[model samples]
Target: EGDSFRIDEPIYLYIEPIGYTIKENPKSSYEFGFFADFTIEGEDGKVLGGQKDFAKLDFKSWNFNTEITLTFTYTISFFSIQVFPQYPDLFSHQDNQ
Candidate 1:
């Protein structure tokens, strides 16, 4: 889940674009393409990590019935560290009751 995360842990993200209906333009003359990039967003809507090498979808020779399934994978790691409390000292010297 996005809400839970361990610091300094490496995470991978696989993104896919769906539900895109392409319409043919008989009158217009233009090329179509798409640039897919990977990004990680924090809980406060901040970008923590992103991929520089973006996947490009070239549709120069593609038709209107073309189905595009652009998948991108990104590897990210957090700089923060997880702090764990030491509880061994609490029961180090226990009294017999």
Candidate 2:
């Protein structure tokens, strides 16, 4: 799933999930999912790691295997979004990706 995330400097790392609804639970046009996140020490080769909860998707694209990597000299955040397909249809889709 080639998913990754990284924040340079100081940022809250804003995010939102997109994909499916209650009734139909169909695939959404925008479904963002966070796979991994971590921080690094500029001066030294140190790293700060964190875990992700796949239970909730933050952003999504059509290709689940796309390469999304944010650069910051020390670390980078990789991600991808794409609507593939869901179980049901006629579901209320939220415009968040």
Candidate 3:
């Protein structure tokens, strides 16, 4: 799917973090962790909504693998639509009409 999404549809985002800091655990294993915050903005650049520390990824591995992928999923429902009714039209299929 493209970047544009319907109001009723869920948004799925995948991120790969490179050159992340890796530390050694007490048991001689490698440990790495990451967290993310997100914000939803309108076309006018106004921040409609967001959350801090929305997702956290932590891993302990025997090998120091640099490749990692983080997935984030979100759906806009009652709260966002209720607060920004006008915004939904921008993403809804009806907008094409």
| lDDT (Cα atoms) of all candidates against the true structure | 0.43, 0.31, 0.68
Q: lDDT at 15 for candidate 1?
A: 41
The candidate maximizing TM-score is: 3
Model 2: lDDT to the true structure? 0.31
Task: Give me the candidate number with maximum lDDT.
Answer: 3
lDDT of 2 at 61: 56
On the 0 to 100 scale, the lDDT of residue 61 in model 3 is: 95
Q: How well is each residue in 8-87 modelled by candidate 2, as lDDT tens digits? A: 21233333323433221256444444443343322223333333442343554555434444322223332112111231
Q: Kindly indicate the candidate among 1 and 2 with the higher lDDT.
A: 1
Query: Per-candidate TM vs. native?
Result: 0.39, 0.22, 0.75
Candidate 2 TM-score over all chains jointly: 0.22
Model 1 error, position 10 (Å): 8.3
Looking at model 1, the pairs that clash are: none
1-97, model 1: which lDDT tens digit per residue?
Answer: 4434454334444344456545445655334666665555444455655565466775543345445454433233433432223321111111112
